[model samples]
Target: MRHDPLFERLWDGTAQMEEWTAAVSHGAITHVADNIITVHTTYFCGSVTAIRTSEGLVLIDTAKPETAKQTLDVIRSWDDSPIHTVIFTHGHIDHTSGITVIDQEADARGLARPRIVAHRNVKRRMERYEASHGYNSIAQSQQFNKPGYIYPIGQRRPDAVYDDTLSLSVGGERIELFHGRGETDDATFVWLPERRVLASGDFVIWVFPNAGNPRKVQRYAADWATALRRMEALAPAVLIPGHGPVVFGEERAAEMLRHGAEALEHLVRETLALLNRGASLDAVLHAVKVPEAYLGKPYLAAKYDDPEFLVRGIYHFYAGWFDGDAAHLKPPRTADLASELAALAGGAEKLAERATHLSEAGNFRLAVQLVEFASAAAPDDRAIQAIRAAVLRKSIENENSLMGKAFLAVYAREAEQRSKG
Candidate 1:
């Protein structure tokens, strides 16, 4: 019911995203409490929080490496206090990679590098990032629709790692870090008991929780719900999420946390029920839906991660990769299948023509499938490639979520290139 300008701009279609970009570039710093300030960044609505302590400053999370300097500058403007400690809520590049700039700033000030704290699993996550750097790079580029967008591999190692919970006294103010499995296996939520402020890493991001990124690593929906409930129990007066705007007001914060947790819990429960009933993965995906009560909630909109993807993630977590479809158990190569389909449809050109018609008719989902089949069967057909590109471009225009738009844009670009070749 409350007005959220950021959410409004984000969902207002890509053409009007200049305002959102401007918001991130400006990095507005807002003081939520006596000494706590939140810096909202342009990088995916990433946020960095700073707490002025008696000794120095304590920061929770950091912006991405490229934009880290902007975040640091905003904090410096508020207080030039040397950063005593930095807490990484997760190992995501956007959260951890920004430490590089912070380190640089500390060095310039001739102050000791701040102690970096994170979950014990962060080191392993970093190592995995390095090992699978290429795969992650491609996946991230596609996910964000940025071609050649390199995923940050090397991250500043944590000076201290905690398994469950760790308590620290910074400038006589108590800060608690709790490990929770959510968007990532290594996730931490920072709590300031005295200030009643909670910095929920990616777990409480404003956009549908991101618990169902279809292309990324495994997400912990059940654990994510549990963590949200824990935050709700705290009833934080100020809630600063990893991304999006800072939430103020104890009642409002509690409701957001409770409703977010409830949405995930509902999906998990419905998904598990379908699994327990021996429903196929496809059946589960189609059957399990976010309750109608939660659908229109501004926080729970399917702007980024859709409910269907969450259902699939839950199915994979509980039932492994098998979808119970015999044809897919040992499926033929996609190209081979496409070739046969093309033959049955008379020719690849026929399929391409039909795909064009579907695209014009605004049936993008099926249109994309038909176009892909034609392209696979006739990889060198210029007409089919052009048709595929056109259809994907239409899909991109129709997409509401940034992730979906990015993926469709990438496909459209690739198809366009193939057509030109």
Candidate 2:
């Protein structure tokens, strides 16, 4: 099967700038196969797949509100299908938040309201999003590197929710929805055996599987690997992921899925081995490594969630919050701890100076820690705040994953603001 030019660019890693620009503007949509289309945008924020059926259309993972309008326009251009059904591959805003746009489009076209389908736990996920609106808003703002940008709270409730799996006959096409826990507990992967196409949602994104987002809720790496293996067994000819380009050809699709599963399996197994041996969290993080086989795969790059973060997440899932460190069992106030550390180092100024030296030596991780101590020890000190901001900015520059960069940028910007004050 011939791949789209955009897909080729994405697969070869030559379209990063174009992808970013398209995400901010109108993302480019291409026909991956007969009646199957994919919209590629910013990997984390927007990317969706659409399938044209005899009845109307089946959409897997609608893009977010930012690019929803453009996504709708692209779908309309392909065919005036009335969007007979919409499926939320997961509850992530990027995948589910854009249903309203499609709903409105269907209404405008005088078509019946599209039935939204998803796993039943999606409703609970949305409810949790609403419950932790403020906290999520802050975290996403940092995660996306958009200060003060509010996370979308409104969600289009699923019209039909299922537990394990659901088989639907829409427009004479056999659609299968299978539940899998990976990035979110309510994740779903849609398989069209007749079309030989698989919509993988976030389970097999181009980047390393996001089984271990440090700041997010629990992610199930073990279950995630199981789902990937299940999908691999189906031998789909084409794979459309939640993020990144579509995978064409049965050989390529299987390779991507199997390797993605292997990456997660390596992390989970290694992390568990260390934990079982009573290793500390830090030790487990350093011990678990991505297999050499996956290191060279374009689809398995650590541009999003790296192996260390995934290991930490697996550790958290298996163990409790405590890292088996007794001193942290009942830690002193951060300010009090910083004060004592400052006194031992002579003063807050000394800590700040040492942090600056570390930053200069390209030891950003330790520099950030030392600066945090300085900031806490001298909350009102502009000099300490300045040092912290500088160190954080350097950390952000050196980071590869968008999540890490966004978080560091948010902190650096905050420190800069505090210094100004």
Candidate 3:
């Protein structure tokens, strides 16, 4: 019961990317023009867009509640004009939860309430969050390392919603909202015709399209790419993503969207081909890769979501958990497998020792895992303390990838429970 060695490798790959992630988040939007404004939101996330003559004060996605407030605070410093309209590029909590702040500000100023808009699926998404609050919270906590997903549910519904495409003049600016799929079911990208500015949500992360969030539900990579190509066709001068900094020029923006979309489409198409060939799930996951050239591109980095994770998502949709091999329908229990592996490695003590050294080598994730297996094998062993301590140190060191950081944080938390017992 060695388990899939690839799974172990996935664990390592996930760990090794932490340093790369840290270096990437450092990219920032330092300045914005008179027509453009950048909001350094508290979701600890950032978003930017240009206010157009047609639209008084147009906004991309609103950050988390606190961050939304911070953004609004910054906006007040500028032209206190009411937001002509607000767009929720997707249903992520950070982007969708701040309508009330805008509503309140508009009310105080007696300015026309800004129109809230998004893809048609946005309402259902917001409702799902309302209904499954606890489930979302737990999943989010694991991914973002947040204390809890509990937040005051804001009753904000998009004032205007559309299915495929919606075009209008807000504050006299011609804006368009087009639907596509990538990170979430209810996702869309907005384009400002005159300004040549595009506000693409998670569809285009500065790095990779967050096409595969293991913790989230279904994602559509094909449509995601289609959406990107559509935007690239528009030839936007400025590109404002859901997260990270803005793309500087029209040609630059087009290239970024084109590559990001290519990365998504490439993974999806490659994944589908493997699925069509009846390849095992593991084979598909291992086979799909966004060319090294794409990975090395300045805009297409691994700061937000990596491509491999998205590849796994496409594979999962085509085929369930089974590897297409009947033997794996119900493999032996994970704990039982761990026990057998532990015995082979000279019992739990040896595994724990090895894991510690791996942690020292900056392989914090592998270290925690080996420690986990060893601890599972012999809960009462004294090495458990040292093993748990190594996990603590590693988690602390992981600041790059949110999930990698969360991995260690969660493990340390669980280890504490073991200690208490």
The local distance difference test score of model 1 is 0.85
Which digits, one per residue and each the tens of the lDDT, describe model 3 over residues 1-421?
A: 1213432332234433334334334322224444667564421463645364444788777667656676676666765666887888877767766677878888888888877888888889878878888887787787777766574565588888898898977656677888887677788888777677778877766556667776778887777888889889999877776765555677667778888777777787888888898898778767888798888775566655656777777787777766687758878876787799888998878888888888778886578778888877877665575577666767567654455566557767766666666
TM-score (all chains, Cα) for each model = 0.93, 0.95, 0.81
TM-score of 3: 0.81
Candidate 3 Cα deviation (angstroms), residue 242: 1.9
Q: Which one wins by lDDT: 2 or 3?
A: 2
147-221, model 2: which lDDT tens digit per residue?
787888877799999999999998887899999999999999999988888989889877788887877999999
**What does candidate 1's lDDT look like per residue over 324-397, in tens digits?**
78898999999999999999999999999999899899988889999999999999888789989989998888
Query: Which consecutive 10 residues in model 2 have the weakest lDDT in total?
Result: 17-26
What local distance difference test score does each model get? 0.85, 0.84, 0.70
2 or 3: which has the higher TM-score?
A: 2
Q: What is the full ranking by lDDT, best candidate first?
A: 1, 2, 3
- Give the Cα error of residue 110 in candidate 3, in Å: 4.4
Local error of candidate 1 at residue 269 (angstroms): 1.3
